[model samples]
Target: PVEIGGGDVGVGCDERGCNLVDHHRVGGLERVRAAVASVLDVEVTAATLLTPERWKSLAGSVGSVPVNLAGELVAASGDGTSVVRFPAGTAQVAASDVVDFFSFPGEVGGAGRIDRQRDWWKSWMSAVGSGKPDTNLPALDLDVIHLLGTVAGGRVRVPVGPWTGGEDVPTIDQGRLVDLVVAMFPVPIPQAPGLRPTVRLLNGTGDRSVDSAARQAVLRAGVELVVVGNYRSAGVIQTRVLHRDPADQPAAAALAAALGGGVLHDEFLSPVTDLTVVIGSDFRMDGQ
Candidate 1:
């Protein structure tokens, strides 16, 4: 079909309520509508779905792109079929192009969970950098991964490895770290515990206790455990360096040293989702 000469190509997750400054008319999508209408040779309306191909093609023309606070799209040329779409990745953008983008905290740069975050961390740890406790070693790429589920009362699953659903424990095969991140909304901690703090664990599927005597084992391990689970999916167990907590230590590092560079801290980050809106005006091909 036809293609626009210059535009922005940025990655975003949500596309329900985003901002578009300098790219389109503020609070007026007429410019965007007109641009798409001219390209499609159709009447402009407020309902459309620009496919990923279209966005990629538009972004390919530019050098760098803007994601506009993450997922965002809009309708232009009516029939609800012709619209705008945004994808996540390191794409192209124009020097003068303007695109809006945003992303959630738990989410990563691209898709699904923060798999990239995990990969990046593994790389960062090799060189090392300065962090809060400030060391000359490369900084660990610590980030949050969002699996589907509530942290209040429902059960959460996390896989303890680089992969999302797999386990990397040296001894335990197909092992999983399932825990309920019990919310302390109503009850706040009175005082920090001097000894290692312990939380309760249930089978998640049922209230049955698997490890009745199961304790976190180490007092303050270097590894941080996270539990992630969605409504329809099973829970997953994951373990990574406790970069966020200053006092906390990683349990895996000691294990990694003994394993001789075989330690598996996979540095994986979870992904998050969001809904954003495209704020701009219609456009005409002739205008550009």
Candidate 2:
């Protein structure tokens, strides 16, 4: 099973930090899936990264829009004849509510507005004075659920046991797997679109025999292998790098270099700590 830790929210578009915060590293199963698919030259699905500017733009759009009594979202065209109205009953929560959810305090310039919002919650009684809600809006637990969904999508095949995620455990069909990879990366494959993907196994069991065999598998598949840990049994090493735009050679090259160079796991890559190469049962998996 995969465990997706709550993503860290911080100010700025610094991709390295944002990536760490977004769980690019230690992102559990999501990271593993991306790495494996990237290596095989297969497509990855539902992989998306939103910049802070984009988040702000969404927030701005939400602010200008008004919520009607029925909580419907209505957008009017510049021309008098056009109007787009979203039905009220379609969503229990307003679009603005969703937008506001990403308006995290300290996410922009570290101003800490999101924390201020939390503080505001504590002061609700003072602000309301004697006035109480007509309907009970019981204590909501933030720990029980998250308001936003993950941005990456893909699947992983572990050789040993049955998968752990509930809805994620659809028997892996070739077509569905292909679709998922396509959706995640949404990019054209390299010289060979028909290329069967391969993965590098970092079984650093410290036995030359085991390492040699794994190396043979990689060479047989025509891929690179950089081993660490126990070459005999298991070890975690930089494995895969996904390519979004095959045409973007520089980007693709940089990604490859990063993976080969272990940039993602580099502690110096970001301030987020403990970017360790974890292996075995301790590792968690998350499906998009």
Candidate 3:
């Protein structure tokens, strides 16, 4: 049980003492999955740091354009996966909704404004108020559930919360958190089918922090960190995840997702390693 407690959120101090607000952290679900996958020796097929930007980029990469309905973005891929996103509670909740949608993408009985100006639940309500949504027009956006459908290979209902959050977070229940995260995977993630992917981490940024962060993410993916060193050659302005064989593609994709998506390629430097992650200066612990 992940005992939730402590000064995880900030109690901003001032002349009027500390103002306690319900502060929460968005994203990091992929990292949670990675940590659990590593500990449990399970291999997840796909992972992505789903954000508006990521959704847009993924749509573009898959060669599709998302229609902006007021503020919500919607796109249907050739693979039959439709991507919808709108600003809302936190990343996990929205994602869960998406997973639900994929299980049953209800037809748009009515359309609502998807304006970027107003995003929160209240604003969403006001925008679709009265005859629009005074009763229950429709849930505008939620792609996380759709993603879960993709991950689970079926429909599922999962709840997200501000478990252990904030910068001063060190005493968090890692084991329990991992348990919760593992549960989020389809069924309980099973043990790896074969040996975990072998990974080579190259620190192109020469920043120890970058190296350390990359190392952690790579390890969290349940891969073999076979080699770690500095990238000797130049021109690596951005992080890149490369794989030598088609088989390692999933592992490479998982690593890239853990690192918040980066340049990916098939370098084909085979017989040495399955995947290579070159840490560039652009990489950040915060997916900025």
TM-score of each predicted structure versus truth? 0.17, 0.22, 0.34
Question: Which candidate do you rate higher for TM-score, 1 or 3?
Answer: 3
- Candidate 2 per-residue lDDT over residues 1-288, each given as its tens digit: 122222233443232223333435456446544544444344344344444544343333223232222333344567866442434432222333433432422222222333323332323322222233211122333211111201101122212111122222212244444433433332333324423332224443333454433333233323322323342345434333333233333432453443342223222322221122222222212210
Model 2 Cα RMSD, 1 decimal: 20.5
Candidate 1, residue 36: CA error in Å? 42
Q: What's the candidate order when arranged by decreasing lDDT?
A: 3, 2, 1
Off by over 4 Å in 2: 1-23, 27-48, 51-53, 59-89, 92-96, 99-173, 179-187, 190-288
Cα deviation at 266, candidate 1, in Å, is: 40
Question: Could you give me the TM-score of model 3 versus the true structure?
Answer: 0.34
CA lDDT of each prediction against the hidden true structure: 0.26, 0.32, 0.47
Q: Which ten residues in a row have the lowest lDDT in candidate 2?
A: 144-153
Best by lDDT: 3
Query: What TM-score would candidate 1 get against the native?
Result: 0.17
